[model samples]
Target: MNYELICGLETHVELSTKTKIFCSCSTEFGGEPNTHCCPICIGLPGTLPKLNKAVVEYAVMAGLATNCEISPVSKMDRKNYVYPDLPKAYQISQYDMPLCKSGWVGLSNGRRIRLNRIHIEEDAGKLVHDRGNTFVDYNRGGVPLIEIVTEPDLRSIEEVQEYVEKLQMILRYIGVSDCKMQEGSLRCDVNVSVRPVGQEEFGTRAEIKNMNSLAYMAKAIAYEFDRQVDLIQSGEEVVQETRRFDEGSGCTEGMRGKEDADDYRYFREPDLVAILVSDEMRKSIQKQMPEDPQKRLTRFVSDFDLPEADARLLIEHRRIADYFETAAKGAKNPRAVANCILGQMFARLGTEAEKEQFEVAVTPEQLHELILLLDSGKIRMNLVKSTLEKMLDTGKPAKEFLSEQDLAGMSADDLKAVCEKAVAENEAAAADYLAGKEKALKAILGSVMKATRGRANPQEAEKLLADIIRR
Candidate 1:
């Protein structure tokens, strides 16, 4: 019997707030191991926790962006668990009273992945395992996080990847989280199961914990699906448990038996009061929501006439999208601007860090000027590329690079002279062209562009070359 895979995700996103969720300690990524921790974050005696207002505001913004229903009244609860990373012995999280619920993120294929809830919580510390030794770092402890839980609506690996990417784009666009997988700012726990093709009930599910990379997540899910199927074929029961993906072996090893909701012994936090989000507060946060990435992508395709692929690339990063719009504004050809930005400009920037630090290198005006020059036939396309490189390297404008490199297109007199030289040099080819060897004209045009050092306009020079050789 054919088996169908069913998967859901629990994505944990670290907020970009200035301080930790319940403490004033720094939430910066890399620091001395335990230095960022304080009495409250480290769970020292008699220290009380306070909620960061910015955390709530950011959570509400995320809810609004994802079409979630913001909970007017929510509260935190204690999840009791013992681990090396969690210092509090009991984690303060939202069990039943989550901040956002019943949301959905739309995919490019027009499928909607329904969200169960987006709850606020604190991040646990990191565990460093060396040779026969283990260490815990509390730097990330008490860092604000929003756990986005999705319903089991995904059936394929492609849908899961697309849903995660779309959700990341929305979160990043709303300025809630950076969603950097490498930095552990964004991580996912995938719950996967396989059932018969026509089965309504799901098979025994395995939860893969803390998958930080999307590529690795796909691999883990694929392997786990096969593992479950193999077990069933062999007549062994598929046990429900927590598993950790082994990157080296490209498989998953069982971690422990999966715990149900009652296993955590959840209860309301006695130290903190319930969070009351008023209607006015929700409206205020909603007012600050930016244009959704998908909406902007649609507008770009319809209004700006950008191809869907180009539009998707632009809207992947909010800053890059904003830069494209600013440069395309009032330009002769917005498509040209989009192409240059996506093709040439992004090629030069190279890395994400360089792209983030890119505002100083090329301005919107400079890009617009480059497009204008190309459109007006003032510079050849080759010169335009070199000009962009020079602009990036020296942080200069396109005009400066064009003028400094003497890259101006050859004048009509200069071009005609070069074409004549090319014809004189390739007399046999010129004669062949006159003799109706039409392909000979292309050879002559190459030589003219070479003689002019690629400054000769190909269209104008071809006209001149054809006219010269035909006469």
Candidate 2:
């Protein structure tokens, strides 16, 4: 029987606050085992928790960026659980009164994943297991986090990946968190279920916890869905439980039975006061929010006339989009600037991480200078491309590599003489051109460009070569 996979994702994003959410401890990653923790973060008996103001503002900005409504009033609650990593045993978080509500992120496939809520919470610490011995580190304890819960709107693995990627791009563009999955700054818990095709009701769902990377998450979801379907087909019950993805075997092993809300035993925390976000504060944060990547993508297409695929590449990262706009502002053809970025510059950046960091030696202003050279028609496109490579390699400005002879440009008479010489040297190509072979003209044009050392206008060279071959 055909079955459809149903899935929902719970994404936990660590806010980039200097200090932990409820304490003054450093929230930096990769410190000595417990060096970054403080008495308050470790939940000493007499210590009381204090909320970080930056955490609230950052969460609100994230909500706004994702089309969520900012709650005017929200309060913190206690989520009680006994885990070695959670120093307090009860994490201070928002429950019924979350800071953001009813948000949604649109996917490229015309599907919208509706967010249940975005709640602020504190992160637990790390657990290191070495040689069958377990060690706990509270360095990440009390680190600020925003948990984005989505409804079961994801039906396929493609949608799951696209939704996660879209969320990452939006979160990074707003400068909230780095969303470094490897560092555990961002992770997802996928809830997977499967039912027969055309089944209206969702089958029992299994929760897979702490998927750090997208590729692994996809594999986990695919494996879990099939496991659930196989159970239903064999007439065995599909129990709802927590599972872990076994990377080595590409299978999911059961961890424990899934717990409901009552299992957490949530209660209000008396240490912190009620949180209030006035319209004034919301407006201030809205002003600080960057332009939506989608809106900027539309502008790139409408204003710069770039192809949609190329525009998508530019807007993938905020810095790359910013650089392209800055350079295009001074160029005669914005499309040329876009082409240079999507074609040559992107080739230099080898990986996704490199593309995200965008650590290029060429400055946006220097790229503007290069594009302006093309704008003024002083140098041909081939010169622009080659000079750009030199500028990228040596971190020098375009003027340093562009000699006077290169920018002086070939005069019309000199260009015609060169084209005549190229046709005379390649008689077979010139004869082929006369025999109605259009590609033969390209061979002669290549010689003209080589003789002129890429300073010749391609259009003018092709035209001159065609006229010379006809003669």
Candidate 3:
């Protein structure tokens, strides 16, 4: 009676547009409650909705980036629901005909997860419930969102995680959306079911909602599978329902019985005009689409001669990849540039939050120049990282900080003097070295590096040490 779990995910990524999907309201997040709302987004009387051209273009870009087949035509339908957050009592969305469909994202394991559809929709406002009263904020109303639904091709929790990571990276690379899960710009709802190993039909599926993180999604699915298996073993039938993922308890709790599609009573909007995407428009979007993450990953590995694992890590963020590309240009060692950026410069930037904060002020060009200067021996590696931190903290450029701190790399003459001084001081180690003690030479090299305060070129120091030892 072995049972296997089946999983699918529905992810909503808010488009990074300047305005609302069907109105002129600003799409900025964390604004004053209802400050960005207008008559149309608030569903005031006699207001007609107009689609944002940027929204449609972003959708097409996303579709192409994900290997989806962009539909020739699509239109918005009204999804009716009764929540205080929904000012219009209905959401404008795509139903039968969506923006794209039949796409697939291949995993590292060679398993392909099929995309059911990617549809555009308007996000609902938010409801902040207090002790006694619930307040409705129309700030989020009418914001553009793309709903990406995947087929039930996922089997284990690990597969779901890989599929999600790859998808998020692709979206970020294409410049379509920011896909920040913590800020609620991206959200996921997972459907999970289990069946006997040989069973042809799936068991009752449980839809888990409000899973904000990848770790939470995997844990929630794993917990649900265990709960279902236990029920089936005890001869109790699994009931379909909508469940909430409790972060504190790390378990799924029933929110309500699963609502049927008819519960929303979806219909076409009468006020808005139908969208007509011509071949020319589709071609324009296809041309504008940036390189896909997977494609870029492969290219980074081949073109830059990076290890596959290193390329993957570098490509995790668009800014990081851009920095690597810029720094590698006309440099002696692109691999060294990659290593210094990730290993030293980034580490000097501190935590993820600090890095993001620094990113607001520091450009990739600045970091690229720093890497080049350090790699070419224009500045010592240790001083380069220290100067970068000062540049970030004080808003000073790298060149200015380098001059003020006098942290430049040692000149060949200065390095030779330090190396000579090191050999003069460490007579015991030098004696041991000349007496056929190879290990003692390494100790003397360390002394030379220390004497120069890590400013001397390590290679030059090693050469000077060996020259002295041989003499």
Candidate 4:
């Protein structure tokens, strides 16, 4: 029997607020191990926690972006657990009521993942377990985090990956959080179960803890799916517990006993005041949201008349989308801008070495100008591409390189002159074209372009060659 995969994700995004959730400690990543902590964050005796107003606003903003309803009032509760990371014995988290609820995120496949709730919480410190002794780093102990939970509507690992990616993009676009998985600013926990294809009852689910990257999550899900299938096929039953993903082995191992909701012993913290969201505050936060990706996609297609795929690629990166719009200003060919950037510029990014090299080159604006130069025929396309590489290597402008190398587009007169010479140089090509040989047309054009060192536009050369061929 074919088994269907059911998956749900609980993702935590650390808000980009200047300070911690309930303390004045810095929330910045990569600080000295214990220096960013304060009395309230480190759980010093006699310290009381005060909620940060900005955290609530960011959570509301996130809610608005994700189509979640902002609750008028939400309170903090203690999640009691004894772990080395959390300096405070209990993590201050939203338990009974979250700041937002009843939301839905739409997927590209036309599936809607219903959001159960979104809540504010303080992050735990880091525990470095080495040499049989665990050391605590309290730097991240009280950082503000927004936990977003989705209903068990996801049925496949691919769907879960898509949901997390879309959510991350939304978070980044709204400026609520950076959502960088590498820095632990954004993290995910997945709950997965499998049921026979036609069975109504759900199988026992296992919680996969601490998947750092999207790639790892996908692989872990596939591995777990095969493992579960084999177990059930051999008459073994799956268990419900927390499991850890071993990056080395690419498989999950049972870690420890899993705690149910009742194990938390949750209760309201009397020391902290409850957060109340007013209508005005909600509207204010809503207005601050950027043009979401879906809306931007539609506008780009309508305004620029770009293909849906091209428009999606352009809008995928906020910087590239903005650059496309800006470059199209007073320019006729928005499509060219999209193609050049996505085709050429985007291929050069998203790597560590490339990122370091990019810092030493011209900005995106300069590259946009180079495209304009190519479109206007002020510079040849080949020269523009080569000069871009030079600029990337040496931080020089394309225009400067064009002037230095004299790779400007050949003038109409110069191109006509080369076309005349190319036709005269090869009698067989001329004779073949006159005999109605279509392939000879390309050979003649190639000769002219080669003679001009590819500085002449191929279209212009082709037109000139056809005119000369008729003579």
Candidate 5:
């Protein structure tokens, strides 16, 4: 606790372009081993590489959404590295002049995590390890990616989570990438260090690479922080190296020595020309960009009069927010629609994947029709809820389950008649209510609901029954 945690993150988001960054090969996920690759992807001689225009556009949209400055001129650089997954032995990436720079992702705690840069690069392939031999899949090789690097601004585990989640939300909202960690669409490399509370100098950092889960990432950073602090207090130095998070042990194991930027031997790529972003191009991308998540959150709260918490839950995914807007377009009470989504509909969506997809049996239009019935007073909330369950079960309209008599609704006189009948049958309950047994009123209310087949409004029936009992 005496040491302060200092952390920075490097997030790699694979753009959903149809083709690779510098090759025409398919970037589709889950292809057969090496089937999607061409001669250019494997670094064959005399195979010229061309940049994908969509990759540039997608990168620009991401930059604009994150409040980054788009560079007018940028160039690709070959980062020399040798790995089995990287068949090219060198990666085509941006180094000196990245596509986006100086951006900040804001945390809910009001702290802005300063972004160092966001650069486009080609992704490496996958390595499948068997008993002893390792097989390589070049299908993912040359897939276009954008690396978002942030300065050492994160100070706590909570901040680290908020930062990553917000980035994922923004990337998915803008349609550049899905940011699914399970599918390797998004991954992070965290640099963690510690210093004494009163010291300004940072301790040596250990970089934890390819942490896909936010929970594991937080644990790794916490363990690494304590590890560094212990080392410093014991008169030992923390080593700067790359590490992998051991999920079973909840600790980070050192992989290799961390390389500085110079280790990559970055040089201007002769195969590709410089990237130019004119005002016209930037404006075009801006028009294609969707609304910011923060702005949308503000609009949802102010326009729908939703509680901030409810609004947040609604906007956590883009599809859910869109579904809400469609269902609550002109409803009298938008909160009811929010309830049906966060409550009844969410119950059926068992997993986070289902919530993200939001594929429900009931359509938004169908839900709006149901809410309209409640708005018109044709059905009470209790009936609405029950009918919604049926509607969800059968994927049918409210009328499919609602009888004509039920939809007609119980008139005031009809409700009073039901109330009187219930009081006549339950004489003991009526007497107990007058005798100051408040709990007995619920029994009488239950009788009325049963007699009317749950058609009578509880509020009206209870009030009418209470008045009749006093007389």
Candidate 6:
């Protein structure tokens, strides 16, 4: 029997706040092992926890961006657990009263992935194992986090990937979290199960923990789906448990039995007061949200006449989108601006780091000027490419580089002279063109372009070459 995969994601996003959630300790990553911690963060005997106002604000911002309803009042609870990474032996998190609820994120195909809740919590410490020795680092113990729990709305691996990417883009665009997977800022717990296609009830689900890579998450989900289906087909029972993906083996290994919510022994925290989001606060945050990426993409396609693929690529990077908008404002043809950005501008960004850094040498105004030049037929496409390279290297405007290098397009007289020289040199090609060999004109145009050092206008030079060949 064929089975359908059902999947849900629990994503933990480390807020970009300057300090830990409950203490004044630094929230910066990769600090000296326990140096960034303190009495409150490491859970000392006499310390009391104080919530960070910024953490709450950022969480609300994220919620608003995702269309989540902000809770007027929410309180924190103690999640009782014992682990080496938990210095406090009990985590302070939201149990029944989370900060936001009932939200949805839209996928590319117009499907909405429903969100169960988004809760604010403190991150646990790290456990470092090296060569049979184990070390605990408390630096990350109290880092502020917002856990976004989604419903089992995703049906396939591709949908899961798209949902994650769109969520990341929204969070990043709102400036709440960087969502850097490599640095552990954004991490996901995937819950997957497989059931017969027509079944109403869900299957025994397995949870995969701490998958930081999206590509690997896709693989792990696929493997888990297959594993569950195989067990059901072969007269074996599928166990509900927690698993870890082994990247080297490309499969998941069982870690431990899954624990239900009651297993955590949650209780209300007495020290901190409940969160209260006033109407003014919510309105302010809602106003602060920029236009959503999807809306911007739609506007780009409609207003600028950009292809959907090109518009999608442009809006993926917020900075690039901003730059494109600024440059496009002054451009005669917005499509040309899109082409230059997607083609010439992207060519200069060689590495992922460079793209992430997004340090373009040319300003939007300068790029607009370059596009205008191209639009006005002042410079050929080939010279525009060379000019862009020089602009990237020197951080100079295109016009300045073109003027300094004398790379301006050749005049009509100069182009005709070069075409004449090409005809005299390539008599066979010229004779073939006169004898109605239309393709031979390409050779003549190439010769003219070469003679003029790529400064000749291609269209004008083609006309000039035809005239010279006919003569």
Quick one: how many clashes does candidate 1 have? 0
lDDT, residue 136, candidate 3: 89
In candidate 2, what are the lDDT values of residues 1-471, reduced to their tens digit? 999999999999999989999888889888898999888989888999988899999999999988899999999999999888987789998889999999999998888899999999999888988998879999988899999999999999999999999999899888899899888899999999998999899998889999999999999999998888889989998888888998899888988744542387888898999999999999998998889988998999998898999999899888899999998985778988988888888999998789888988899889888888888888878788999999889999999998898888778999888888888899999898899999999988888888888889899889878777776
Residue-pair clashes per candidate? 0, 0, 0, 0, 0, 0
Q: What is every candidate's alpha-carbon RMSD to the true fold? A: 2.6, 2.0, 3.6, 3.4, 1.8, 2.4
TM-score of each: 0.92, 0.95, 0.87, 0.88, 0.96, 0.93
Clashing pairs in 3: none
Arranged by TM-score, best first: 5, 2, 6, 1, 4, 3
* lDDT score for residue 63 of model 3: 84
lDDT of 6 at 233: 93
Better of 1 and 5 by TM-score: 5
Per-residue lDDT tens digits for candidate 4, residues 1-471, read 899998888999999999999988889899889999788988988999988889998999899888999999989999999877877789999998899998989999999999999999999999889999999999989999999999888988889888988987788777788788888888999888888999988888888988879999998899888888889999999988888899999999988754542277899987888788899988888887779878999999999889999987677656667767876655556776676666666577876334223333556677678777866767766776677778777777776777633545567898889899999987798899889997898998888877876788888788888889888
Q: What is the lDDT of residue 158 in candidate 5?
A: 91
Q: How well does candidate 4 match the true structure in TM-score terms?
A: 0.88
Top candidate (TM-score): 5
| Candidate 1, 222-303: lDDT as tens digits | 9999999999988998988889999999999988654542388999999999999999999988888888887899998988
| Local accuracy by lDDT, each model | 0.88, 0.90, 0.83, 0.83, 0.90, 0.88
Model 4: clashing residue pairs? none
Q: Write the per-residue lDDT of candidate 6 for residues 106-216, one digit (tens) a residue.
A: 987879999999999999999989999879999999999999999999999999999989988888877888899888999999999999999999998889999999999
In candidate 5, what are the lDDT values of residues 330-381, reduced to their tens digit?
9987999999999999999998888989998899999899999899888877
